[model samples]
Target: MKLLLSFFLIFPLLLSSQSFEKGEKLFVEGKFNQAQLVLENYLKSNPNHLKTLEYLGDIAGQNKAWDKSISYYKKLENLKPTEANYYFKYGGALAMKSLEVNKIKALGMIGEVRSSFEKAIALNPKHIEARWALIELNLQLPAIVGGSESKAIKYSSELRELSPVDGYLSRGHIEEHFNRNTEAEVQYKRAILIGGSKVCYQTLADFYKNKMKQPDKANKVWEEYKNKNNKGIK
Candidate 1:
């Protein structure tokens, strides 16, 4: 009888596991709305399901629902304060929100954004994304707030140690921001050569289109990028 009771007790957990697996598979298959519904329903019964919360946060981010993303990530932050990725995601969402708000509100939110990235790096020193995000944020803000090219350079140095391609990209962003077209082009080209990511290709293409005044070169690069991606389609 006790063994039978144990089986009954375990059955609900088994169902929950199956449900979560199905939801996660749906998410991976790009059925994000369906996955969100399934996961949200699951979270009703399992309120503290950290994985579900994380996915909800990511889904919100994909949908560009910055407020929802912030809520979900903040919950995850409270649940797992030591998690570096949660802070990074939370900061990113907040930064996005800042852009939608007025200047005064954006100023405060920007500070929070920087603080979150700082915490993320403090938790995981080698977090390349967090480091890069911080560098970009510092470069954009004014000197009165947190804008410091020197700080951006420091983070760029650390990123260089972590990833040469990302280091070049950061330097390119710095140069581009300061309107140094020739230097920016050189750094961006080096970044593309070092890393074959879509961001690298797009960055150089944009530089050519806008800064270099070489629309033909930009069109060629963009066409090649589209062709390369289309080849991967099933």
Candidate 2:
């Protein structure tokens, strides 16, 4: 009788461990549908499983099931709201939802995306992607909808401070689009000086040749780019 009780107690544990392992493997392989089914079944048996909730969120996100993903992530957040990655993923899922929906209705989702990203940033100030996304969203949004150049610049500056080397290009983008030619030129040059990029060189060439009508400078930049990339490549 004692032996039977021991086997019964161990059976559920063994089954749960196997199920979790298989579900994780499926999740990693991008088999989200199967993973979701397996995870949902596991959750039925283990309602408060934190890891199960986290993985369910991931699977939902992968499948682009934003509402389901949010539901799972919220459960995880309720359990532990301090986790930065959870907030980031949640915010990212919201952003993806905003993109997937039609444009007219998409703006409605922006508020949720903005709020989620803000919460993520508040929880982890160093989250670069969240900062950049917020900046991009603000820049693209209409002025009537609370977008402002000053806010974009603020976030851009924060991004630069956090990641100086790659941030120069973002500054260039804002300047170029807003018609701040001199500032844009300076930023593009700074980006090239810090770490050479083919795209940066091409951008500078385009700015000089077309926008500024400086063919000599453009030709020089293009030549440098070509020489660096085309050397001994047949």
Candidate 3:
């Protein structure tokens, strides 16, 4: 009778563990809908599960349900105050929500969004995405409000110190925004030479096609990328 009671006690815990693993696997496979069902069920039993909350937050974000995403991430922030990424995600959701709202509301949200990203950086100096968010945020906001090319450059400088590729790409983006096409092209080329990643190649190609209005140059860039990859396959 004691043995039967122990099995009954342990079985539910084992089942919950399996359910959690299955939910994580579904999330990784990009089956967000299925993952949500599994994770939501798991969360009912494990209310304080951090990873489950994060996955649910990510799924909500993927669905563009910004309010739901923000709620989950806020809970995460409250539960795990020390984690830099929770702050970042909370800030990102706020930023995206700002876009859907009116300008006045967005202006109101700017402080919180900036502070969240700032908090992430304060917690983890090496947090790349938080720095990138700041760079874009600074660039996108109008000068009348708070935008500053100098501030964007400051983040770009930090990115350069951490990752040269991101630094060059971001600098190129800033230069392109300012219509300094030659300088932007130089930065993009340097990024290509240094990073040689798909993003680097695509950024340059899109710049050529759209910004520079040189389709032939874009085609040539793609050809070069294809040739390089083909050689690696050989």
The Cα error of candidate 2 at residue 45, in Å, is 2.0
Rate residue 7 of model 1 by lDDT: 100
lDDT of each: 0.90, 0.83, 0.95
Tens-digit per-residue lDDT, 1-234, candidate 3: 999999999999999999999999999999999999999999998988999999999999999999999999999999999999999999999999999999999999999999999999999999999999999999999988788899999999999999999999999999998999999999999999999988999999999999999999999999999999989921
Please list the Cα RMSD from the true structure of every candidate, rounded to 1 decimal place. Answer: 3.4, 5.2, 1.3
* Candidate 2 local lDDT, 105-146, one digit each (tens): 888877877887788889889888887777777888889876
Q: Given candidate 2, what's the lDDT at residue 9? A: 100
lDDT of 2: 0.83
TM-score winner between 2 and 3, please give it: 3
Report the Cα lDDT for candidate 1.
0.90
Per-residue lDDT, model 3, residue 110, is 96
Highest lDDT against the true fold, candidate: 3
Candidate 3 collision pairs: none
Q: How much does candidate 1 score in TM-score?
A: 0.87
The most accurate candidate by TM-score is: 3
